[model samples]
Target: MALAYFNGNIVDMDDPVIPIEERGHQFGDGVYEVIRFYQGKPFMMREHLERLYTSAKAIRLEIGKQQNELETLMLELAAKSGLENADLYMQATRGVAPRNHLFPKCPASISITVKPSRELPQDVRKQGVQVVLLPDERWQNCYIKSLNLLPNILAKQEAFEQGCFEAVLVRDGFIMEGSSTNMFIVKDGKVQTTPLSNYILAGITRLAVKRIAEELQVPFVEKPFTPEELLQADEVFLTSTTSEVLAVTSADGRQIGSGCPGPVTRKLYEHFQLKVK
Candidate 1:
């Protein structure tokens, strides 16, 4: 069963608990995180929480609870849903206030929902997916996972209209990342991805892939690459919390690396499964 939580109450998923003046609803003033649980156990819970707090701080909004307290609430919500494999989405906002542009002096509003995991089809995972390259039009603070996602949503929708899974965002002739995933390419047997910066969100799954690469002794490099380079690479792939490690067999309708999920992506994905287990 799916569940919804607001402040300190577990409410019906469709109930309207947030006021019309809630900052998140009015101005997108919030930070959020989607945590995945397998068999009721969370993966990298600490890292996810840290990033959540970091995003809140970057936006000058307080979550109004200690990290451990939020973690406890999340775990309890996930367990209460009775879903062994679940996705817990949590958000912290600047709270309700009368129509105004300034920050309000009110306790932050926290909401959470837990539902069964949305797993991709096995065929799509095995055969890989296509992506469209779009210009990066997000704010300079892309590193902060804030609620202002208009640009990202637009790009993602554009990709979907084109029969693609994700929008690979490019900035200044270099690939930044996907609209919601980190981009990677394999060249000369080395894993290459964009280095951490304000231009891209540092993905936890990307970090996991780096660790898996090291464990397998595969060379991992962090640097920006152009679309031409991606097309010329030995392989292409992407990573995210939901997507995990997914190969990019086509970009902008161009086939990549024999138009299949490459060997390195398969190996890293196998190790990721092991890590989760």
Candidate 2:
């Protein structure tokens, strides 16, 4: 089953909820989150809410509900959907107002939907995926999970056109991250990724990887690595709420480290599966 929520009402997924003047739809003025539920339980729901609120605050928009309240609503909605494995997508917009460049004086528009979780093909995950490097043509505040995603969408489409699964975004000759995931490279048995900055998003799954690495006694370093370094590394991987831990076997038509999922990536993913249980 699938469901949609608008303001305070739970409705059918196909129901018309938001109006034409919604800021999120009009100007992409909002922030959103996707929480994965496994066995009817949410994975890191609190962390997701914290990031959502952080993004809302960064954009000077109020979500108009406490974290716990939002969490409860999400849980109830997911439960109603009855999907054991689900993805709850929620967003908060500035509200429906007259089309203008200034903020409106209306209550924030909160919309949410819960549907089946998406997963890649088993063979694709087993063999790993390919990515193409693209310029980071995005705003400097990439840290905020804002609704403005034209640049990202374009990069992803370009990667798809190039027969790639993802696009690794680069700025100033260094890898920032994937269009939607955090990028990492394994070198000499250590994990290296770009450090947290305004140019990079602090991914929740990336945080999970760090903690799992510490628990597994794997050396995880947060340092920016060049595309050349990534191409020459022992292995490359990416992490995100939806993608989880995925390997990158090639980039820019160049094979990376035997062009297979490496042992470290496999081990980390194995542990990540257990953590989500």
Count of backbone clashes for each model? 0, 0
TM-score per candidate, chains pooled? 0.99, 0.99
Can you write out model 1's per-residue Cα lDDT over 90-165, one digit (the tens) per residue? Answer: 9999999997999999999999999998898999998999999999999998999998999999999999999999
Whole-model alpha-carbon lDDT for candidate 2? 0.94
lDDT of 2 by residue, 1-277 (tens): 9989998998777777779999999999999999999999999899999999999999999888999999999999999899999999999999999999998899999999999999878998899999999999999999999999999999999999999999999999999999999999999999999999999888999999999999999999999899999999989999999999999999999999979999999999999999989
User: Which portions of model 2 show Cα errors greater than 4 Å?
Assistant: none
Error of 1 at 258 (Å): 1.0
What C-alpha lDDT do the candidate models reach, one value each?
Answer: 0.93, 0.94
Candidate 2 RMSD to the real structure: 0.7
Which window of 10 residues has the lowest lDDT sum in candidate 2?
9-18
lDDT of 2 at 260: 98
